[model samples]
Target: MTPLAIAEHAPLFIVLNPASGRGEADNARRSIESACAQAGREHHIYQVDRHRRLQPCVQEAVERAKAVQGVVVAAGGDGTINAVAQATLGSGCAFGVLPQGTFNYFSRTHGIPTDTDEAMRVLLNEQPRAVQVGQVNDRVFLVNASLGLYAQLLEDREAYKAQFGRRRWVALWSALLTALRGHRPWYLHLSWHGVQRDIRTKTLFVANNALQLHQVGLPEADAPEQGQLAAIALKPLSTLSMLGLLVSGARGRLGEADSVVSFPFESMTVRPMRGHRRVKVATDGEIGWCAMPLEFRVSPEPLWLVRPAVAPELEATRQ
Candidate 1:
C-alpha cells in the first residue's frame, strides 16, 4: 500500500521487550494499559520473547497494525526501539514509544515523557511527524552507532549490567572501570565529504541523535539532525589520558584533549585498516560484529515519529 496521509489517526500497537530496564518494562504494563484505557485509545500490546530474535515479532506486529493506519509503538530500550523503527522504515507506519528503558535516550531526546502514564497520554493525543534517522547497512539506529572503544564499552557495560543490575549510572560507572583497564586503537580508512583520511582511534561515534551526545556531555554534538551527522574519532590514548578526557568532557571542555577530533557529514564509509573482514559495532546500546567497509548514512526518508504535543525542540529537529 502507498504511504498513508501524514496526519492519519491510527490505533497504537505496542511491542514491548519484557527484559528491558531489568524487568521494569514488564512491570509498567499495567500503567500503560490503564493509561491507554483512560485515554480511550484502541491499542494492542505485545511482549516479544527475550531469549530469541525480536525483529520477526516486531515485523508481525507492524503488519497487523496496517488496518489502523499502521502505527507501532516500541515500549522498551533503545535496541527494541531500533528494531521496530527499522521495521517501520518504508512500510508507511508511524512509530511511537513509551520510555520504559534505563536510559530512555530517544524518549528524552524527543521531549516525550519518561513517565509511562504521561507518555501514553501524549501518544494518545498526538499524530506522527517525519524525522531523520541514521542507517548503517541494513540496520536503522534511533541513536548513535560506533566502532572500536565504544563498541567494547557497550559490551562491557552490558556484562556489568547483567551482573550488577540495570541502573543507568551504574552501567556508566562499570564501563568506566572497564575502560580504566585500557583500550587499543584501530587504524581506520574513512572516506566522507570528498576526503579520504587515516586515523588510529579508540572510538568513532557517528552521532545522529542529540540526547546520546548529551549523555556523554558533549555540547558540540547536541544537534545532529541538521541534515548531517557528527563523527568523532579519538586517537589512541593511555588509560590515564582516557580518564582525563572523560573528566574534561564532564566539565564541557572536550576540546582540551588533543587526541580527540570531530566533524559533521551527511555520509561516510569506514573500514579498519587492519586486514579484518568484520569488526565489532555498537548501535543504540546493542552490540554485534558487522562486516568490513561499513557504510553509515542518514536515511533519505524521514521516519514519522509520533511525539508528545510538548516535545522539546520538535520545531528545531523537524528542520
Candidate 2:
C-alpha cells in the first residue's frame, strides 16, 4: 500500500488530552493545527478536559476514521493513548501518536519520537506499521501491567502526579518514597507457557516493551527477546537496599541482582492467592483495580501505528 501524506490523505482526527504532561498538552493544539496547516491536511482535532470525558469523544473520532478509512491520532500520554488505541483496535484506521506524556513509554517503545513537531512530521509522511499489543483481561496496555508492589507504587505515583505534577523523576521519587516508607509483600500464583509457580514478592512486573526498562537502569535481553517478558521482582530488604536497587537498575545490573526473577513467554495469567475480589493493577502508568484472576495475552496481529520511515529496530522488525 502506498503511504499517505498528510495534505492529500483521508480526513485525520486527533484526540488531545489537555490534562496530560502538566498542561503541556494544552499547547499541543496549536502545534498540531500549525503542522496540519503547513502540510495542508484536512483534519479535526479534539481536546479532552475536566468537564468532558475522553473515551466517547475518541470513539466518535475513531469511528469516523474507520468509516472513511482515514486515521486517528492519540496526542497525549500513555493513558490517553491506551484509550484511543483500544478504540482504534481492529477498526482498520491508521493510528498515530504525539507523545505529550511524562514517559511517553508507548510512543517511545514504538520508535515514535518525543519531539512534537518531528512526530507530526513522521505521521504526515509515513504509513501505518504493525506492532505487538498486550491485553490484561479486556483492557489493553502498550507498555506493561503488573500487580503486587508495582501496582501500589503506581497508585501512589498517580497521586503524586496529580499533586506534585508530571515527569519521570516525580514517578521515581514516588517509587523511592513508597519503598522507604515500607510496602507489604504478598504471595502470587502465576501460570504461563505451560508452567505454574508460586512466589512471594513485593512487585510483579509483566513487561511488553523493553525500551523503558533501559531508562530505569535494567539490562534487557541482548537480542530482542520475546515481545512479552515476565519479571517477578522482590522488594528491597530495607530502605538502604532500595537505594542499591535504584543504582543497580540504572546501571542495567538488575539481572545480576537476587531481587528479581525474569522469564520470557508469549503470554501469562496471574492470580493473587489472597482473597480479594479485585486486585490493584497498573497498566502503562494508568492505575486501577481490576477483577481478580487477570489473564494477559499477546496479540501478534499487531496494532497498525504510524511511525517515522526510518523507525528504530524494535518497531521496524515486529512485522
Q: Top model by lDDT, which number?
A: 1
Alpha-carbon RMSD, each predicted model: 3.1, 3.4
Q: Clashes in model 1: which pairs?
A: none
lDDT of 2 by residue, 126-160 (tens): 87877678788888887888877778888889899
- lDDT tens digits by residue: candidate 1, 105-168: 7888788887888887667777676777998877787788998888888888888888888887
Query: What would the TM-scores of all predictions be?
Result: 0.91, 0.90
Judged by lDDT against the true structure, how good is candidate 2?
0.76
Candidate 1 accuracy as lDDT: 0.78
* C-alpha local distance difference test of each model: 0.78, 0.76
How much is the lDDT of residue 108 in candidate 2? 74
Task: Show where candidate 1 strays beyond 4 Å.
Answer: 1-9, 50-53, 214-223, 313-319
- Flag clash pairs in model 2: 149-202, 217-249, 217-250
Model 2 CA deviation exceeding 4 Å by range = 1-8, 216-225, 312-319
